[model samples]
Target: MEKVSFVIDDALAFIVRAPLVTPFRISTGQHDELENVFIRLHASDGACGFGEAAVATHITGETVAETLENLQSAASALRGRRITDPAAVCREFAPAFADNHAALAALEMALLDLSSRVQGIPLYRLFTPIAGQPRLTFKTDITVVIGSVEEARATARRFAQRGFDSFKIKIGKDEEQDLQRVLAVREMAPGCTLILDANMGFSAQRMLAFLDRLDAGGARPLLLEQPVPKQDWEGLAAITAALEGSGTLVCADESVGSLASARRAVETNAVSAINIKFMKSGILEGVEIARLAAANGKRLMLGAMMESALAITASAHFAAGLGCFDFIDLDTTFFLKGDLSRSPYLDDSGRFDLTGAGSGIGVVPELP
Candidate 1:
């Protein structure tokens, strides 16, 4: 008798620059075109899986060049490894990018995808068994990029027309301007779930002051994300503590890069919730952070970088399998002018049909 080994026979990395439906502005910068890196891995039996990573220098300090370089370097070592054990796949190549989570995430996702496809199971089932569940689908919020009040209002209306009720508004440019933009959206659509993402743009004092006004108005948003800089753990804690009684809950995004960073943010009481992005924290470590969030009574926001449908769909599968995320922002694909791949899990309604069966992430990468 001979033992079979799950050997990865080949690996390839490539980049695709996807244009946004409209100019997207966060506090740190504006993006009309998003450069994304994608990976494909093949097993000895010819089974292949695809993964994606989007670079945002402000969030992950990774550019298209760096992501591809890191992916290529890691892919070289991964080509000949047996991936029956997924954790080992991460351990082998994660070091290529000590601080480059986006690149590492792409590699980790590809390996996970490849392994599951060989076994002919959806990607999430690899993390946890989905033996008995009502359904696996999830609803996600749409993001409204930083813009004028009217522009924000129009964007809100557009998504709402598409049957979306949750919206994440990008802020951190100007305090007053940001507030007015939120108010504009709120006034236009009072019943929608509103999330304000500062993207680490506000000063501690300014953030606190603005929250105070929102609280007084009795319309503080459902959440505030990375109000201050990522390094300002004390500031994050102060804001979270201040909003304890009855105000917008604070969530950390940029502050969480890996399992250590996510754990530290929770230990320091930085925020009430943590935004877990696969691009900022690869799937392997991101799951650990999700466990951390669950144990600490911290809320989870399953988010994504500016990648296409493939990456966001992978993130969604993880979220559905975990069954613990309180919020979902896997809406980056909603803005993509064209999908690098098609995701069967997602529909125009911004929902994931997790019950849909197949192999891997239920995505087919369409590269030009």
Candidate 2:
């Protein structure tokens, strides 16, 4: 076997604005572009690795500027040090900068990438216990932005024709409008898996009413995501209870960020499922959250934060390795203006091909 060789020497981050295919809106806010931060780490052995993060003002209220500052402070500790234990590097930094999740995510990703390169294996191989065969690809669900009934139908039809079997519809603008959006998509693709993302815009009563309307209309959604505000655990639990046995799963999105939040959600039974994102939970923390969710008998799904290929691929590898995600929302690369990495692109079926050439985030492209 080849010997492992890696010593941290330099770390840097750069900003890029990746335009979206369409304006994505939720209850909190919307954006037409992703303010992304790209991280690069150089080792003493003349090898390098890459990581990226998408800073969202509405979700985490973290901007590229803020993430950059935190990245500088967080990554500085790794310089002149040899990274023999990537996971330990992340675990050690967890408590000091618990608030800087996006920064921590980027930094953790860089360390994992560096580790993968040194070991001459894929990033997921370094994950928990390592999968027996190391699954390297996964299908992603395409998201339909909040829009009129016609736009919803059009979006569903477009992706359906491209062989996508799952579609996530953005809702929560208004009760009646939200109902119509779901109906439009269901009518267009009745066989496809459907997810309605409210982004914490609904009240408990409103959620129940909408579920009633959905039942009346025969449009069974795969799940309802973040129907109430993040802090209102009572409301989330109420909605989840109301929808129990109704075939519609309630998923927690914003309520889960760090392990603390994940534990609270699990202990309180806030929802039947969770939408895990590396943007909120760092690479290490995200996996831990998934383990916690599974242990609690809660279904798990994976999502992204307007990331480019580097970050999206990293996340896909994480979820695919664990092999437990029931839903996937890592299709941000479909909205990106250009490819950030080679062959991390999704297939025609909307599945990410994580088995790409090169190591360390799979061959970074020419910085698009």
Candidate 3:
């Protein structure tokens, strides 16, 4: 394949507000709407690519204002740069973006998208060599955010009716209510795989007790995600050890923000799975982490923050192209209030297909 190179003629960043159908609550906070940053990189050859930065203050500590400011500086630095290798550019810019992973991801995503378009190939082709093959489709899990038991049940039923077989339930607020919500969701979505995400809401002992209760009720989830705080390595290791033979995997989310953190988590055996989010690891680092996790035999899961289809589609292309993730949590787009125009790869069912997309991410969202 001939390499296509082009100078970045223009770079721009803007804010996009996407409203959710309902307030999505986690242990740390709640979101009724999302204010995120979007990036557009225009190549000298008239090709353009898009990216999105979903700002989660609780997770990445990046606000929209700071993200925009940082992006402007990055845009200034990226202009006139010849990009034959987008991933290499991303790595080159890593040091400067140490404090802002989401912004870096937006830049990397835009570069990759633009490069793929310049080559007239789907975005996944850039990653197929690493994956060993191409993946055509992937199923995603829908999240039932922290809410009342009735609300959870209703959400589960609605999604089940829509052919969603995997459910990620947000818990770790009120112990009793959280348990009730889990059980209610289970009742509504029978035989479905359940993933419990606490978002750093519990102590090790408390999380164990909650697990015991779930086991007693025969509703043990398939995975327990980030029950302890992000920096609580001791708590995470203890919980992982306690769940060694309990048929549940301990997955790290907030704890693995960078490649170094992910390496530490794997070396310490603190968790059995790693949750890879572009907003946390950026695109290149996320791929490296995925490779690292796979090499170390750690289960891989791909997730997204509160984002529109534009960002989710980019993630979908990456995941589908790589074909390595064991669990898919790219359901945030389903929570957005509107048509699925931004996410052309996603469908009414919780599935993403990249076969139909054209060059690049194959999604040009109608941003307002």
Candidate 4:
């Protein structure tokens, strides 16, 4: 086993123009551009692995300063360790930061990226065996942020023309306004799958009323994500039951942050699906949570947090192995200025294909 050592080379923060298709508003922001944080981890062998922490202080309470502090602290613990096994490295460094999942995820991802590079195999191939190479298809949802009904309808029409069949609209700002927006979107793109992500901006009663309005408007959503607060398991369950068989499934994104929370949600039947994100639960932990969701008979959706190409590619590698997620939202990199890499994973239809021949994510050109 090679004695693994890593150095925290540089941390870069960039303000990216993440314009929503509509004015996206959650409990977090009404009109905001995404602030992305990128961490670079360099191994002793000159192999570098990158990790991303897209911060939304209002959503996850993780600020750039706090994330950097946690990464620095975790980086110290990761030095001079023989990390021949990526999964073992994750296990070893996970507890170092106590309950800081975001920081721990950064460390684990760097180690995995290094390990795959060392073995001369892509991270997806390292994780699972491919039988029949399937074309990795992902359903990216066009975001409809809080906006006027006419704006929402126009946005829906634009996305429909772009061949996106799924739409995730931000709701819970106003009952009448949101209903109009939903109705307008439905009218514009009647065939597209609709998803509502409230981002915990509504109370249980308000959420129920909104769901009721959706039902009455004949605008059934494919899923409702984080309608209420994360801790309101009872409310989530009630909403789930109320929407049972209404062609509107409920998925938990903020609530299912950890494996334990996923298990709890499964035990209490709080959601119909789990939204798995590498940004939230690291790649390895996200994989474990996906397996747990599979075992518990809950479908999974690999979600993203406005990451760069490196992080999004890493996530695509992970998602390639999991053949169960009914939906995928890996379009974060598409919104970047330029992917900071050469030879990025590109498919025929702009989706990433993981079956190509290469090692350590297949492409590690100098950061562009």
Candidate 5:
């Protein structure tokens, strides 16, 4: 790798707690507010870039305080280092920061953003010489968090009226209630495709039974995501095998967080699709996993935690740059109380147009 003529001079970390517009509930718990760590890295040439880490205690097992400490420790190690290659930097730091993947991911984002800015190119351009498209457009699915049946219907109707054609329903709390919520959403938005995400709440048998019930009710979802726990590889494999010719995709989200896990998922045929989230694997590993999944014919879904526009925009650039993702679920920013950050993308209905983005993820934070 050719060495870049820039040295990291300083690093700063900020803790931002933003309230969600509404409670975002999954099988694990509910989140009314999200705490995120933002890292700003300065280069020797007076250029700087930003990165964000959404601290999910249940998902990453790192609280905001722990992530802050981790980021500070990483910043010290990153000082005075020349960024010859951002991916190499990420790999080199992976072992030292193995306990905090989200922290390392934030650092990787800042490094990539800084490097791309230094080169006077969009962040996505650093990954691919040819642009994904002149406009970098992609459609995103809006999520309807776990709620009452009426709430789900109202949410679906509102988003459908706004032009969203896809809905990801959070389920797995009560199979019967979950079925009702799905039916409610489908009734409100009859033509929209449904993606059911249990977030590792159900067992293999329970999920299979639920699928049978759904089929009986004549309500078919396009995807079933993480119906079983993350460690239940056999359960995942069983579900995948059960859905062999059903035209329904079984996706592994929490199960496939890293390259090793993704390889195992592919080898064992645990699921047909893998969800790519930078918070889980960091930017470099996420990209590597995406390539691995694609090469093995596993479908790709780009997703995120409850992040602000900073990380969401970075993810958008990643997805648009690679152009390999089959589904985009980067709509977490909409749950924020207000605009926590700015992106170069224009949202029309569920589609994003990144024609207005400048270099380095094209995201500017509106500090809270």
Candidate 6:
């Protein structure tokens, strides 16, 4: 095997407009737009890999300034390291730059992209069982962030009209208002599957009451994501219990931060599924989480952090290879004005094809 190494070849950041038609609040207030960050890694052998840092201040406590600082620190560490294994690079630098999950994720993705290229295999094939299953197709939930019932209903109608069959609504603004929003969307798009993401904005009492209302209304949610804060394991258990056998699955997104968290969530039966975001846990850790979820009889969902096409397409490849994710939320690229890379993933009927081969993710468009 050739000795693997990485050089801090180039780094750049750009601001993009990710405007939401609604206010987009849950625990926090309105967010008009999101700041996006992208990173590039060039190997000594003329191979390059890409990653993204897409974040919101309310979601992961990462702002544009802090994310940039973390990237700079990672870039500095990459100046002269002889990285024989990309995973080792992550293991070494992750602790040094702890708490910056977004930054760590970017570097880890770039390394995986480069490493896969070196091996001439897709990143998903490296991890998943590829024997009997056809290449996976990903379908992400279209989000209707906090908004009026009318606006939320309108958003859901638009997305459903655009071939999206799954919908994720941001709730926890108010119990009654959330109910109204969900009801409106259900009424507008009767055939679309719905999931509620509270974003850690509810208490145990609020969650139970809200579930009661949803049950009474006959609106069966596919899953309830992060109904309580990450620290409130007991609350999550309560929520899970209340919805058990009701056909409403519970998923943990914010609560399952690492492999350890995944194990704990399983041990405690906190959720029925896990939402794996490569931006939140890096590729290796994300894979580990998926394995843990599968071992525990829990399903997996590949979620994104509002990334550009480069990052989202990379995730699409990963999701395609996994073959175990019950759902997908890799549509972050749809919100971008223009992606830097060409050959982005496209699904005319809400079904994406991941037949590309070789490493460094097969869909990277040439940068002009």
The candidate that wins on lDDT is 3
Candidate 3 lDDT over residue span 225-289, tens digit each: 99999999999999999999888999999999888999999999999999999999898889889
Q: Which stretches of candidate 3 lie over 4 Å from their true place?
A: 1-3, 128-131, 339-341
Q: Ranking by lDDT, best first?
A: 3, 5, 1, 2, 6, 4
Instruction: Provide the lDDT at 273 for model 1.
Output: 92
Model 1 residue runs over 4 Å out of place are 1-5, 129-135, 216-218
Q: Measured by TM-score, how close is model 6 to the native structure?
A: 0.88
How well does each candidate superpose onto the true structure, as a TM-score? 0.94, 0.93, 0.96, 0.84, 0.95, 0.88
lDDT for every model? 0.80, 0.79, 0.87, 0.68, 0.85, 0.73
- Per-prediction tally of clashes: 0, 0, 0, 5, 0, 2
The predicted structure with the larger lDDT, 2 or 6, is 2
Comparing 1 and 4 on lDDT, the stronger one: 1
Query: Which is the better candidate, 3 or 5, if ranked by TM-score?
Result: 3
The sequence of per-residue lDDT tens digits that candidate 1 reaches over residues 243-360 is 8866477999988878898889878888999998888878888878988887888888888777787888888778877788888998877777755535677778788788866888
Model 2, runs deviating above 4 Å: 1-5, 129-134, 341-345, 355-358, 363-368
Which candidate model has the greater TM-score, 1 or 3? 3
Error at 223, model 1, angstroms: 0.9
- Candidate 6 lDDT, 1-368, residue by residue in tens: 23454554554443444554334455565455556666666666777777667776677787877777777777766755566777777788788546778777777777777777766777666555422453555666777878789888888788888888888888987778899999988888888888998988899888878878887886778888998988999999988888789888889998987889999999999889899997678777887888788877997888877566667777877777767778887665555444442334556335676665456676554432
lDDT of 1 at 76: 82
Model 2 lDDT per residue over 71-166, tens place: 776667778887656777778887765776877888888888877877777776666532345455678898888778889899889888898888
- The global Cα lDDT (0 to 1) of model 4 is 0.68
Lowest lDDT 10-residue stretch of candidate 3 = 333-342
